[model samples]
Target: MQSQSVPRRWLSLLAVPLFLAACGTPESPPPEDAVVRVVTPYTVRSLDPIKQGLWSPEWGYGELLMRATDDGRVEPWLLESLEPESPTSWQLRLRPNIRFANGNPLTAAGLAAVVDRHLAENARVGESLPGADVQVLDDRTLRLTTARPVANLPHLLADEQGISVFDAAATEPSGDIYTGPFRVRSLSAEELVLERNPNYWGGEVRLDEARIRFVPDPQARVLAVRSGEADIALYPPTEALAQFTNGSGPSVAVAAQPLQHLRAIPNLRKAPMNDLAARQAFALGVDYRQLAEDVLGVPYRAPDGLFPDVVDYALPTQRTDAAEAARVLDAAGWAPGPDGIRQRDGVRLAVTVLTYGSQPDTRTVAVAIQSQLRPLGMEVTIASVDDNYAAMRDPAGWDVGLSFDGTLGYTYDPIGPLRSFLTSGAQRNFGGVADPELDTLVAEMEATPDEAARRPLLERAQQIIAANRYVVIVAQRSSPAIVAETFAGYLPSSVLHHISAQT
Candidate 1:
């Protein structure tokens, strides 16, 4: 299940000219009631909820039926209550008085329409909710039906990428189509302007507007905050934390344990990596401690497994031994060549590591991997692409890929990452992992309702992933942000988009 290539126009957003323009402008002093300026590495190329990815919810321009707490517990947000009526059925009651940005009331029919649109537009939705059907019980209540008993239905609905409630009547992408804290005032490749939704159902929004600017370069984001050109700079370089913590300028707020974990995925479908010993060598060759402490800086640590420590079912910390890695390569007949790189059957133990610019730290981590693996007689080539997913779909383009994998924050459970990346024929499985055991475990976990009952299955699934060395878990990152003094008390969340100013 390969992902489609990103539109050329969308990739054009990362052009050198646009990056220069973003860094060229100097922000003017804002009035007492001015828009809050936010500089981040992400950009929203499309206003369509289906194509927006996480930007719609992150910008507060759209809302989901359910939301997750800071600790990753799923709770009703747009819905007043969600209870399982049966194994395959659930009753959803929307919160009363909820309205879109255009002031139109949110009814069960409207919600149904949004669901239907998603099912029609996205194949993943239909695959996720097989034999899906929705019935509008009344103005506020709806009954969701599925062919299979989805134990984590609530978590699925809570996923912003899965289903977002928007005004189906609206013909185009605009603020009116969404029911969130903010409305899309204006959007471009470089910037997005969101105005507060006056008819917000939850409570009064303190800020009048939010101006989000896209700065792909981590250093540029840091400079933007230091120069007072941005109110909040998201994902600033970890090495630059010293400047923010000096107490002379803006302050830095780091998440306790961010759900984002940097992973190095090897192309199991390609040469050298196709061998289990090669994959194991690659994993053991990496210095997880140095990557977490020296390279990633404070708050970041070597991951226990595929997930962060915050996840209850995460496996024990993976082992790292360069000597063992070398021994494994030697035992596998990969002898060191004249240039010190291992070679066997005339094929060098060379790998192309792919990373994207969106999460700037991925490139840094890739470079570190290149350096660490060199001493182990592995030739690591780094290819920093604009779009990693698209590039990764073609295994010939790269051997190993460095990127962030979100567990609780993105999917509210470890099941999502497992099913998406490790299961047979799963989407985003660029590493080409296909294990019957892992697939069976994931299916059982999905069928099992209680979290307590599912813990063992989750643990076993992680063990399988680790044993196979499907992905080299580098380190868990701490969500770092530099904030202006005016927004001094701003704290970054493990959930990337759950942001707010401390007024």
Candidate 2:
């Protein structure tokens, strides 16, 4: 379903900000500098909203012209309306009286400039969508033309990866001007302070000010919540659930999010993994249920497929059978070696796993997998690296990679993640997993305009991956937050971070 108001509203800016502000009446306005403190494990890689802010914007400093609604439907935020002129071209109508935090009027030309800069720097968006071009017709109207019929253009513009509009004249030290409900007062690597945007076109800004502190350490995050140093703790150590629920400070809030899938990528270019039978045996062998329930803690479900349950075409949960796994390994000519590790022609079944050190959960998962595979005659070596991608590039460096694989595509479509993993020359395709059948399905899904029509194709693509065991699906993760009882209006989706006071 589409939001009708946004599709037509893009045509005219004509006194919109004034009309909306005057007609809308807020029941209660959030107090000035109310200061809701939030501590999260995520790091803001860049202070620039256009770069890092669009994804997490942990401090809630910037706003995109459009955003995905609670249900993953596209809705206009800064833009008054968005409509497609053609399969390749889209027109965006600006809202009048929209100003940045610095009191600068956000013009169409300025917005276009920022988008142009982003396009120049990153070739992925344009290449992925094809002929992605932006043009400003006037102060109120802007046009975007893709090389092909991309039905999800609005979702792309408002995507979490980037595409947030910032002031073209913004500097590194001063940061960029934002048009969101909250404006950045000051932001350091360690902490960020945001005040209400008085000029917000969305009517009364409910949050007057918010303090977001970066606490990457899970233990530190839990401590911040218990000590009342933070009003909310995001993605703390899964084990810390007891501390919050056991009358510490706040209650744990859990939302089932299939957006981020924890999967193991077997290097397709490497030795044992190059054989499809070995990869399939690896997938069937692991005790994924035990890993999710016992090791990863509660609220996280074992992943059935790459996409989460939210997507219409997500595959149903598969049954795990160790006997079948062992049979496949034996059939593949792998026999138990001297130390019980599988071997074939003097080669041992030893695999190296790489993961990011920042996430405590990843380490716990790796260890659990290691334990589970030992009985199956597999020797797993864990290497926690600062950069998982860096390790992935070296074919000889690692055999299996454990990480979240579907976050980027969660907001809109599965094509983004699918293309990244399956595309022949795609940068993020760590294992060099290339399958012609999978590529054809992905291309068809991408080209198809109707979501309903694309469903079957997407399902088929996922089925192919499952059957071939190109990647090992471990568990689908839910983003859990520990929040104080007083906090309210925090929408628990893959996207959205800002909150309102209970009162």
Candidate 3:
């Protein structure tokens, strides 16, 4: 999923202007001439840096690296250059020109401090996978030696959560401070105000300040964009219904690919379902194309593999096969019953899938699945469970867990997710699935340093997952945002927000 479309005229030339926010002091009204006022949905879930998920672009709050984008690749933002001394070691050329918002020059010590702090900590993994033990080469350069083969390093360096180097003097050992484009100027129960970084080395930010107003309800998020209360609204699940300016003006909602991969993780721990046929029946019975396009109005193509466009090794699987599904179920002794639900021996083939949170048009899709599968003798049930997806992982609570696999493989290395499904992976037994074959593939993927040799193993592993029916992935699609036509400078890459500069 790379965008071949070049930056449009509106995206490149427009400078979205800003006025002094009312929240500022009388004397310090926000700079009349600041950067774009981007109104996103999420607020400061936690200022405690390491715990933040990719969801936290709150990178706006931190600074240590400068961002430079080249088409699809992310080069060093804080460091001027990088010289690999060896496979395990490299010397980083620190940026002398980069400065923290607090006016501290981005020296080797600051870079070293950022890396060293995470040695004992898990430092957020977003896409880069893991942090390493960094050795200070000198005041201007540092050497890093990874504990293992960290192929995702380059992508990680660009991760706003992990790679945005932090200023040492700004925080206590607790690890919270200002680093990126803005700092939290004020916070009340309802709103958060952010101010520009005078020492910001990135470039000129057009807004004097941005007021991040929180809107929890999905409807309110849409309303904010429609009413003009918010200059930019995020995660507008109801974008289709709302009018847009892209072609139609203010009558629209705005956002970009925020997250995708809404999926169903079938619990392989139970019998019958633990049995392959039951799972296959579930996979083949539901129609995802209808769910994505007609029901949701937001369209997406069926993915050939777990990772569609961005991840190269993911190969496509066979399309939904009702005949195969029926055959598999019959072979498993689940024959159609009087009421359409299947019954095997003495058991009725009833499975419950837990879901929570509404996005765009999920209710309709879930309902359609239930209706479609009933005739197959499989009774499918959908329930809302937003607060805890782990409950679906609970052996006693569900037969299938319905949730999006947003990061899936993109979150870290392919292994970061591969390890999760392994017999010993975290978020364990999401489907309570354990295959010796999958375990072996993931193991090789983790230990094998060479990606060339790992491609087949990775490909085969994805096939095993689909073949095993541990999951029935709906159409693979990333989330989309309708950015205001006036917004620009943001280049969306395999890595989102590599350069979300509002020009």
Local distance difference test, each candidate: 0.78, 0.69, 0.58
lDDT string for model 1 (403-470, tens) is 78775545466676778888889888888988999899988877876789999998887788888888
The C-alpha stretches of model 3 lying farther than 4 A from their native spots are 1-35, 45-75, 79-93, 121-132, 157-164, 171-179, 239-247, 251-259, 299-301, 358-362, 407-412, 422-425, 482-502
Off by over 4 Å in 1: 1-35, 45-47, 169-173, 185-191, 214-220, 238-242, 326-348, 356-360, 383-386, 407-409, 498-503
Off by over 4 Å in 2: 1-33, 41-58, 95-97, 102-107, 122-130, 137-139, 148-151, 169-176, 407-410, 488-493, 496-503
Candidate 2 lDDT for residue 285: 74
The pairs that clash in candidate 1 are none
Ranking the candidates on lDDT from highest down gives 1, 2, 3
Q: Write the per-residue lDDT of candidate 3 for residues 1-503, one digit (tens) a residue.
A: 01112111111112321122344453355544453444556654434444442332443545434342423234665667765555555567876677665676766766666565444354354223343566666778777666555544554565555654655454321112444666555544456566666766677765566666667766676666566555555555644543563564333322233235667777777755777888888888877667667665543555444655455575776356777788888888888888877788878899876767655344556787888787777887777665435576567767876666653433335665566654544565577666888887776665555668878988888788888877766765544444444543332333444222243
Candidate that scores best on lDDT:
1
lDDT of 2 by residue, 123-166 (tens): 55555556566777888888877766776666676676657676
